[model samples]
Each structure stands twice: as C-alpha cells, then as structure tokens.
Target: MTVQDKLKQVAESLGVPFVFEDWTLANVEIDRTPLPAVVYVLPASGELDFKNGNIRDNQNGMLAFLDKVELNGNGQDNDSVVDRMKSLAMRFIVKLNETGYFELLGGVMKYQVAYNKLNAVTSGIVFDVTLKEVTGICERNL
Candidate 1:
C-alpha cells in the first residue's frame, strides 16, 4: 500500500472520518457537519533521499487535522479544548507508531489550535507530521 493508503487505513482504524488532499470548509458541508469532526490527511512538501541507484526513500510532511472542541452548555471551558486536542494527538501518535508502513521521522511536530471564525462551536487541531516511507523489500543481485 502507498503512504496515502496507509494513512487512510490508520484513520479508519481510529474510527475517525478521513479526507484526502481536499479538505475545506465547503467540503465540510458535504458531510453536513457543523463541526470539524473529520481527520484530514493532507500531503505537504517532501524530499526524496537518494540511496543506491535504484533505491530511494520518501520523507513527506503530512498534516493531520482533528477537532479541538470543548463547550459545555454554559460557556467556554478552561483548557477543555486543549485537553481534547492533546488526547487526539496522542491517539494519532500511537496509531502511527503501530503502523509499519509509516515511520515517524525525527522532527519538531508543530501543533496549533484554531477556532472556526465562521462558527464558534467549530474548533480544530492542526498537527504537522514528518513521516518516512519504509515499507518495501530491497533486493540486490549481481
């Protein structure tokens, strides 16, 4: 399976709705979702590490977008959204670690909490992931 396929599979295992490269507010309407409840695996910039003549590794930057929401009927709760975001992030990390196809490369993973300006109830967590594709057999024969 390709990297994208592995990502989608991971999201499926987590029971989180998965979207491909196209994930915009308009696209959210397709799901009739008032909140950002879907996980978007977007392909970002990447670099190809040249190995032997025919072998190379692809290191890619993928963005995982999750919901960061916490709103009791009363009002905005303190650190509730942040707590939820961390939980989701941890879950994602665990899932990625479990997958043999995608390897988490060493890099500073950036995270940001964003509020939906259009709708206050809709908040989101953006996670930047550095993944290395290492699922293949390398054969050398003279």
Candidate 2:
C-alpha cells in the first residue's frame, strides 16, 4: 500500500476524518467537516537512491490535527483542545511506528500549534520518512 493509504488506515483506526494535502477551509463545504480531523501533507520534495540493488525513497511530511475553535461562543477550551490534539498526535505516532512501513529520521520531529482565520486550531508534527524496497536489479539488467 502507498503512504497515503497507510495514513488513511491510521486515521480510520483512530476514528477521525482523513484529509489529503488540501485541508483548507476556504470552501464552505469544508467548514462542515467534522472537527478533530487528521490532515496529511507531503510538503517537501523526496529523494530516491538506487544502491546495492535496492531503492531508498526518502521524503518529508507533516501530520496535523485540526479542530474547530470558538472564541466568544461556548465551546471547548483552547487548552483542552490543544492537549487533546497532542495526545492524539502521540497515539498516531505510536500507530505509525507499529506499521514499520516508514523509518522516521532522528531529531526532526517538531510539534507546532497554530490558529487559522477560520477559527480553527491545528497541531502538527513534521518529520522525515524513508521507505526502502529491494529491487531485482540483476534480473532487470539481464
């Protein structure tokens, strides 16, 4: 399965909506999406290395937890929302690790919290990922 497919599976296991790279709320329909959603984006370019009869695919991506926020209206507290997102992010990382499909690079994980103009808050983690697969170089060359 592909990286996006694996992420969708993780999102399904966590019982949250999964959005691709485009999670912008500019569209009115997007505003109606349920809160506490998972957004996955591959924001950086990737590299492919062919060595030792194997292909190494490395890329950088981000996983974001998004929720609707209320300023004056009665809603969940901002701190609580952020805390919940953090917890969810941790769980997500655990699940991703269990998959063993991606190798996470060390010292590149960054947790960020930001608010958008649509009164939505997001907590995200950025990391580098690598996927290696053995290629039958001899057979192909023959």
- Where's the lowest-lDDT run of ten residues in candidate 2? 130-139
Clash pairs, model 1 backbone: none
Q: Per-residue lDDT tens digits of candidate 1, residues 50-130?
A: 455433346344454445345542235425555566676677677877776756543566777655522344455666666
Tens-digit lDDT track of model 2 for 64-93: 776666555333466666778778777887
Could you tally the backbone clashes for each prediction? 0, 0
Q: What is the TM-score of each candidate against the true structure?
A: 0.65, 0.70
lDDT of candidate 1? 0.55
Residue 110 displacement (Å), model 2: 2.1
Predictions: Cα RMSD each: 4.7, 4.6
Model 1 CA lDDT for position 71: 50
- For TM-score, the strongest prediction is 2
TM-score of 2: 0.70
Could you tell me the TM-score of candidate 1? 0.65
